[model samples]
Target: MTSLPEDPSPMLNEADRDTAVQRLQQAYAEGHIPHEDLDERLHQILTARTRADLVSPLASFPEEEDAGTAFTIAAAGGRIKRQGAWRVPRTLKVESAYARVHLDLSRAVIEHPVIDIELQLGTGKAKITAPRDAIVDFEDLHTGWKDTLYKPPRRSVSGGPTIRISGTMGYGRLKIRHARR
Candidate 1:
């Protein structure tokens, strides 16, 4: 006999309900959902009591769907660190003010053929780094800075992975550094 994955419906909570509704609204505005359907689904989601109930209506948006192929990490006035295995799509977005955003792509997979980064800050900064044994592809690169610093170095690792970042930065600095294994 084979074991099946456990259902996640029991994990749904009040907070999840709120988040799901917000995402649904955003999807509607982004044209991911039609107005009539949005109205019907939003009502159901608001009254949903389980994870399965909440997620059933969201099937139209794949869990891995990258609406804009963009992943965002933002800190308004503090520091934020995101590590572990992650999926990188076509675009990455970071926005902060007096804060920092760091992406440690030591065990991440870059699936997009062309990766782009777009960052905006009021008085904050952003950083994206990869592990030593990673492989990166940077054929299409675009970065912008406004009243801030943007620093990315060029180097190679003997047995480390590579991270290719192509994006924009506004009003802040972006520093790309290497992670020590």
Candidate 2:
């Protein structure tokens, strides 16, 4: 006899199953997932009776539309980082004081054509790595006791979204760069 999981997943309805199947098919068509993964996830989703059983199969897929959180990442003298394969919301606000923050969007899932990032930092360091084709605009960003100077070697391509960063940073360091494709 075997024991059950601590938290059993709730059973899935027909609509939920249909949505999952459609997401898998769309991901496959967009080349987000390989052929093997598409086949495996389709099988898993078909056989999955509960929502929790679909976790592993849909792990590599991006979240559905409006699935990203809308809350700001607030920190006080702490470290905050958003790296690797993560979802990036359209509008993001980061507030911190004496904290170290790093945001790497090299392998992120961006679902918008324009992204707005408002950073309010005080006495700390922040590093943002955007996609190579992304256009970063910080002209309206103000700094006290230090200036935010950003000069890219080359112009941004007409591919990725335009990232607009505006806020006030006091005596802190801000580094922004475009990651290679």
Candidate 3:
């Protein structure tokens, strides 16, 4: 009787290992792989003994280089442009350590049709601005300061949209401004 060959490919080259892992994670996030199966496969890949062991499954997805960035935007059905009416999902989350993010939506139309503008921060500061009518909702605002003159300015327009700002700040400030009608 003849013995069949075992599957190989999980044993990828050192340079390609990280890329493979990232691709797997992306696939999992995209719902291409089932959760249970992904977990099992990931375990196998991590314990892979040789490059040949990693070739089979890795071939299922397209090969690509890894782009290093902590924050990732998965805008499936939204129009992101330089100038125009901008309509994004109400829930916006800025997580982890972000040194600074300046958003200027002066020329864009912002409608608060969603629930709230969520901003979750770990470290650093973020500055966001929109039309005066835009609603700003901050769930948790934490400024890690004992006593200082610098305080996040909060403003709202009369008979206009509302602005909500909520998040934790570590010695940082949040400023909100509305367009003059």
Please give each candidate's TM-score. Answer: 0.42, 0.60, 0.40
**What lDDT would candidate 1 get against the real structure?**
0.61
Ordered from best to worst lDDT, the candidate numbers read: 2, 1, 3
Question: Where is the poorest 10-residue window by lDDT in model 3?
Answer: 74-83
Candidate closest to the true structure, highest lDDT: 2
* RMSD list, candidates in order: 14.1, 7.7, 14.2
Error of 1 at 154 (Å): 8.4
Give the per-residue lDDT digits (tens) of candidate 2, residues 1-181: 1122345459877767787787778678667799877777899999999988767776786555553546588988889899999988888889988888899887998877778888899988888898888888987788886666565637547777788888888988788988866
Candidate 1, TM-score vs. the true structure?
0.42
TM-score (C-alpha, index-matched) for candidate 3: 0.40
Per-residue lDDT tens digits for candidate 1, residues 26-75, read 67765677888987898888878777787666768634354444567667
Task: Give per-residue lDDT, candidate 3, residue 57.
Answer: 50
lDDT of 2: 0.79
Expressed as tens digits, the lDDT of each residue in 39-105 for candidate 3 is: 7777666766676656655556543422221223322222212334554434445544545544455
Could you say which candidate leads in TM-score?
2
| TM-score, structure 2 vs. true | 0.60
The candidate with the higher TM-score, 1 or 3, is: 1
Q: For every model in order, what is the number of clashing pairs?
A: 16, 0, 27
